[model samples]
Target: MKKSLVLLFIIITHQAYSQSVAKYSNEFMNIGVDAAAFGMGNAVVANINDVNSGYWNPAGLIGLEDKQMALMHSSYFANIALYDYAAFAMPIDDRSAWGISLIRFGVDDILNTTQLIDSQGNIDFNRISLFSTADYGITFSYARKLPVQGLNYGINAKVIRRIIGDFASSWGFGFDLGIQFKHKDWKFGLMARDITTTFNTWSIDEDLFSAVSDQIPTQDLPETTEITIPKLQFGVARSFTFSYDYTLTAEVDLNMRFAETNDIISTSFASITPAVGLQFAYTDLVFLRAGVGNFQNENNFGSESLTFQPNIGIGFKYKGIQVDYALTDIGDQSAAVYSNVFSLKIDWSLFR
Candidate 1:
């Protein structure tokens, strides 16, 4: 490669991977999944106590005593996009458990505008069509509790797929590792996401995309290949009971991305994001939660990025069934910024 051209390519790559651009592979994998987790500022790494743990820290499933399942749905970015998740867990033995989970996110019935032009350079409304852009994943998890009570470990293997109308698609595979330890009334958790590094291989219909490019020759899309960066999260949680039947749990978590300033991995950290959450429960039946999330932009307001958002949620349980709801204030970017999340959890043993 020529020296000058190589320099240009390097610059472009760095800009594309910048925190603001975030053109990361399988980016959808990072979606804040369930209502309970989202309610706690996505800081459930150590506070997970339900089947939804399959998506956060699978090790949290080691204590399961009954067959459990959960379902969650969210209307993100107002009502323009939809996100759904479901998971089922079964105890394999006295101290071992397995779970399967699926997540799907999509923007449905999107009008395809590329083919809106007619042969006569005149307006033709019929040329426009509707299509969907979707992303999905399937995960298998296994967790085991060590002979030393309260010590557990888990691993997850997952397959991911993304589709953009009928023009492009990508498939990816990745693994996650987690460890959890509890002593007295405190819990500690560690999770390594994408331990083996996720790879997304894209297939684009050259002819179809070329047609769109020809419509406007000034700009073109970049290559579709992608490699996701690995990140680590650590969390601690503690509960305090004040009254006879009321208890409060507090949690703190730190997320670190192992990338350098140039978006390259190294010993140095690219960013360290911190979050805090609090949950109040009444006799383990009704719960209220609130938290703050994504404050990484606070240090760099000049970047035109959002600072942080407030999360609020409430849930109740009856007869071995749990229901949860969460509302996230996504700043003033748009009236549709608020996100609504709902989730339901059930223990099959209750019926048996």
Candidate 2:
């Protein structure tokens, strides 16, 4: 009874806090995957491992006892197709480990347009430019077991690139720092990512323009737009075992972005999300899992004006290989019903 009440209080507090900072950028990269599974519950950062850890919490590498490699991909309802992620991790010794990862988010065939008018009062057709947009990041990571029993610390550096049509693109760099501690039955985790701000500039060419009206001739104009990524994410989670094979866990996350006076957009908004999950393991050979997340408003659309109110997922494991899948709804739009994600993971180690 008391425990249930405490859980309720925590959920309410987390929901209120999350509403305060609902506006942020690079949402495609941040939305995450392993739906139906990770989405069903609030994505708890501390427990993350496998390939997703490259994007969630780098410190999780400390808990990995073996060499691991993983990949994940998803196709959203719209014509949008997400690419894949791959990661490899190996322990140097009992106390230290190192890893590398690659993540790619891609979109297919977008229509290209140019500002032009023909003599017959008709629009001039510019050659169709079938191009795609991609966001790729390469990351290097290291983690060490701390002197304090179950405590671990780690960091990761990432080089990021964004490519649009022939007209625009950008490159940037960032870093993430993380720590985790476990005592008895309690666990805690923290992560600070995207420590550096990145930007991209585009130059318009004069040849791409044509005459518009009688007096005004279309001229290519050069302009630059800069996007500032968010910084710092904090998470905490707890797990309890009800039986030898059944366990329940809860997790919460907070993303913080300090506002800059010189920036056109303010970063005062923050997002607080909480998640709960159930895991059932059968004789260590097979496992079943389910989780749900962000049950508060369940309808509030943040920066994208797209509501991502709920998510669910499942996973299976055999020997050293594991597979996971998730489904999500990014709200229904006039053009399409948006959401979907899939993931695969593998871990191998030569123990001493």
Candidate 3:
């Protein structure tokens, strides 16, 4: 029975063991951090300026006035999976800034049923074990103001680690580039992720893998190497102030992938997803945000329909400490699993 289960798992992951460029490789890293960004439909690429920017648009780190830190936790699939993130950033002189961030997404305490039956063909209740499958990402970022006025640029070096309950593990590396420009109340930004093509090399435990091969006489095993292609995000934003106390900001973003997808705009060469976000503020203390994104064409049976994900959030800020909450969807509206996201950000300047 244990061998049978292992065979099933191997069959399900057969394609994953091949050397290829997967469209959804390293997907957890793209989930985005910070409830504020989630509440704003991830459209703040143009105007973001905080510790969280290390994941969104590193160039925005240049906006940090002092040391800053942020943390976030969210659960998905009804709490079966947990996602956590933490980041720190500080200004470097007046022309440059640097930041570091860590992210983890995992399903914990999974029962390892492969050992449920003992070698003596007897049921061994104590043979069962617990393990976890998790993915971790660490990013180092640096940003500097360009010689040209109102322009800033940033770069990121990323290391990725993945583990599967001692069954398999992998290591990967990648790079990202970002640029942000501000002119008056208008902002523009561009982000290029996996610019050099991230690659993951998987090292499978042969002792564990052989257990499956022993069950099947004609099975071959091979090492796996996965690749992630480049993706680009472009954004524009503007802020409006009224009555000396009221403010509103609006932003638009375009996400472009290299291959055809279910996005609203698709071609053989590329696909584009558009997102729009709005924020209303009172003296920059209290805030309300709403946005919609993840446009896709869902096909039910033989019919197709358009759907999107909508998000709403609120925030409170006092003396450089901010708390934000967002109600967002893990997937698009077509098959949505709503999740509540909360995040906290602190400006160390207040303590200094």
Candidate 4:
């Protein structure tokens, strides 16, 4: 049964590989990073100020006080897939900051059963082998405070890499732009992902592909070029201080995609999904966070119903090192079950 399922997956994946202007291409990049952000429903664009900013809204990097680094890991699909992220950032002078980040999502140790049945129609378990599929994203980011005291802007140059065992591979590139403004306790942010459409060119190993070709004689070679469109994220946040020892921050964000989908708000020209997050801190050392996002309309038979994902997290900071953990997809609104995400952030100043 498992071998049959694997064969089906390979066939479907190959069929979908002939892509042009594909929607949800390079989707692994959208899964997000940092347990703190995950706990906050990924709504930190306006007030982010750490190494992780390289993945959210680079403009937020301007708030970094010193050199920093971060790492995060999460598992999905009942531990069948793994997601990992790492980042580094440092301030340049008083008004600029630069960062680099990497993300990897992969499913490993899959039984390649394309040859499970021998040419003579005999079943041979030894013909099975193992392979893996993975996607990676690396980003270089820079942020600078504008002359307008409260404004800042950032840019990202991204490189995307993907591989499917020894069968295929691809490389892609893209850019992102972000801006942020702060006034009193209010913060606003905008992030244009793939500001210019991203492109990925694929290369298939014909030698290994011959096996698949033999199975599907009618299948043609997959297309080489794949395109990803742009998406926009807007955020607003406010901080409230309750006494000298306690504080709370609330943020709301909207993700706009150019194509219509099952998001809460959809139209022919665009679709909008909203998310909200909240964080409470005590003297900036301990934190509690929560957020809800991924609002979608589900169809049951001929009826429609609303569903959303809820995430919660906690954090601890000592000196300049912070650790965070989050429980996401609490209600399993999506296909994947709940996942535990953990992240670590280090401030170089702590060691200095």
Task: Give the Cα lDDT of each candidate.
Answer: 0.76, 0.56, 0.87, 0.89
What ordering of candidates by TM-score runs from best to worst?
A: 4, 3, 1, 2
Model 3 spans > 4 angstroms off: 1-19, 214-223, 330-332
Model 2 Cα lDDT, one tens digit per residue, 266-338:
3445434344555555555454555544332322455333223444556677777677765553343222234
Candidate 4, residues 1-352: lDDT per residue as tens digits? 4447446555646644644457667888989999999999999889887898899999989999999999999998788889999999999989999999999998888778877778898989998888888899999999999999799999999999988888778999999999999998899999999989989998978787666565544344555788888999999999999988999999999999999899999999999999999999999999999999989988889999898899999999999999999999887875436899999999998998
| Leading candidate by lDDT | 4
Q: Across residues 288-323, which tens digit of lDDT does each residue of candidate 1 receive?
A: 999876663332445544456678899998888999
RMSD of each: 6.3, 11.5, 2.5, 2.1
Q: State the lDDT at 37 in candidate 2.
A: 40
lDDT measured at residue 193 in model 2 versus the true structure, 0 to 100: 66
Give one digit per residue, the lDDT tens place, for model 3 in 36-138. Answer: 9999888889989899889999999999999999999999988998999999999999999999999999889876667676678788878877778789999
Q: Which ten residues in a row have the lowest lDDT in candidate 1?
A: 1-10
Summing lDDT over every window of 10 consecutive residues in candidate 4, give the lowest-scoring window: 214-223
In model 3, the clashing pairs are: none
lDDT of candidate 4 vs native? Answer: 0.89
RMSD of 3: 2.5
**Residue 140, candidate 3: alpha-carbon lDDT:** 100
lDDT at position 135, candidate 1: 85
